[model samples]
Target: MSVDGDPVSETPTIKEGTWEAIALASAVMLIVWMFIAAGWIILAGEIELAQKRTAVAAAFVTAGAAVVTFCTVIWRGKINERQTNTARDQLRATEEANWAKLLQDGAALVFDSQTGKQSAGLASLEAVVQTQHRLFAKQAMNLIADYLEQVHPTDHRSPLAIAAIDALGSGHSLGFQAARSLKFEGPNKDNKRFAPRSIWVPILGVRLVRYYGGRMDTQYPHFNEACRHSTFEKVYFSKASIKDMSDFESCFFRNCKIEEIGYMIQENTFQSCDFSGAVNFGIESIDDMPDLRPRNNFYWSDRPPIGVTEIDWASRIISVPSQFSNVFAGERLMTKEGRDFIADEVLNLQRHSN
Candidate 1:
């Protein structure tokens, strides 16, 4: 009976057993004939002739044996090569499984309730990043970014928070398909290190859509702290107030609302950004700013920000109280009304060279 899933032979049953029987009978007949020939060569009257014929037979048999030996060596070599390749493939598969297991175990640690376990989990996730697995890297980064998203708004500098920040920065080493934005939702006294999310998130360049448009670096409006070497690109500072913030170098303030900033804006690059969106973009005088000079212009010697559109001046309140101190693009300010409106607010920001 044929087994399940096994193929049945289609050849006639009479032909199958007959072929093997015929081959066995043929071999038996050949052996009998060989024995008879050996008797004739050894015991017949022409002994000299028999000796010569035996030598000839031996020569032919030796040649045949050489050919068979060569073929056998070639066949064995091919078998070895195929086996080696199969082994290598198996080893690679096993290694990849180990890496996947390591990643899974480490990611689980990050969600544990204990702070120490969470820290260990973060470390494991970072280790996964080192493995250079694309999916793992993305997941690791998302975990840290999510953890940071949980931070409260009191300017938390905790060891764990610090680790999370560093993890995100390191996780995006490859820099493709990144979870770019982090939101600092609000402050909490209970978990002091958890968040001062609103204030510091903006300068970090992650757009806070609730506060700004994209990543709100720091969303809290009413803190008088000094900020340095931060970048704000395509940013909208709608309901925020900054004081004593200095050295905002090479930054792009796009569609920003400069509502009532302190006079200490110094050594900062605010080029290539649009301030046209503000209903009342107001600033205190830059007379206290040490870098203010009649010789230099804010919009001069600078390329426009990465995504700046053609700026319109007439719509907002434009007034240049200091003509020589035009910080915006010099001749590009086309409209009289736009210029008047922009100048009005910017003049308040203009510095006295005295």
Candidate 2:
């Protein structure tokens, strides 16, 4: 039979078949000898003549069987050992391939942002979320979005749901960026905003990631083509996890201004998503200023049984959008009150009996 791709290894089946055929051949030869001795094939004079004729045929058959048995057994054993040793190598190659694809896509996003090929990279990242591979599907897609947010800072990006669905891939910290970018827009003429595209290039590009089981870590053009049509639109973050983020300090939202976002994260963990100078903030008046604060010194950690796995305030100074107004509203908020507020934000998401 044939298969779509090259068989990863082939010795096990050959080895088993060789052993079976060897045993069958030995049994056949023994049966033939016993029949000859018992005169089953010949009578008197004819027996000697028949034996003479059959002896050469039997010799050839036995030799052929021995050659097949010996060759398959020996060759199969060697090939099987080689295959076993190469298994780890195969896994490593797979991982390297995944990483390469990821870097390629990331680079493309950066280039696209600089060249104005797309307003956002969320659609490109979302394209890979449908992959069947579970290992890094979420991580890779989310990271692409993260890289995009870092590279491009504007309001004309895709909605956050693109990342939300991707985050559902594995719930890693990386996926939180896209989740945090989540926002809702009513179906309108704004296909450039959050809906599907009129041109199928982006969709087709994303569809390729799905074909590779979501492990298209090296396909740059795949992402660049997908988000090529995106114009700077609203980016929202919703239902995020701190444990899903990596290099939290290095990450930024750039110049985008997020709106109408409902995000809940675990407390006392490092901040999974950062919206510092990276986001546009678009604060035109003091009213918006009331809700803005400088965020610093944050990290991510999984919650202990007694704690929660999340992005939390590493220091009292790292205030978030939700807590900005409460911490710095005109006059300085009391130290005790601020600490309590920060503590409350960390502990208030929900009470789980761990």
Specify the highest-lDDT model's number: 1
Scored against the true structure, residue 92 in model 2 reaches a CA lDDT of 61
| Alpha-carbon deviation at 269 in model 2, angstroms | 26
Q: After superposition, how far is residue 256 of candidate 1 from its true place, in Å?
A: 11
The estimated TM-scores of all candidates read 0.40, 0.27
Model 2 C-alpha lDDT per residue in residues 248-339, reported as the tens digit of each score: 11122222222111121111122222332222212233232222222222111221111222222233223433333333555322344444
Model 1 Cα lDDT, one tens digit per residue, 104-211:
776677777778988888888777666666666666666665666654333335677767756655654445223545434333323322222333442221222122
What lDDT score is found at residue 20 in candidate 1? 46
Best by TM-score: 1
Off by over 4 Å in 1: 1-78, 135-138, 150-159, 175-183, 187-354
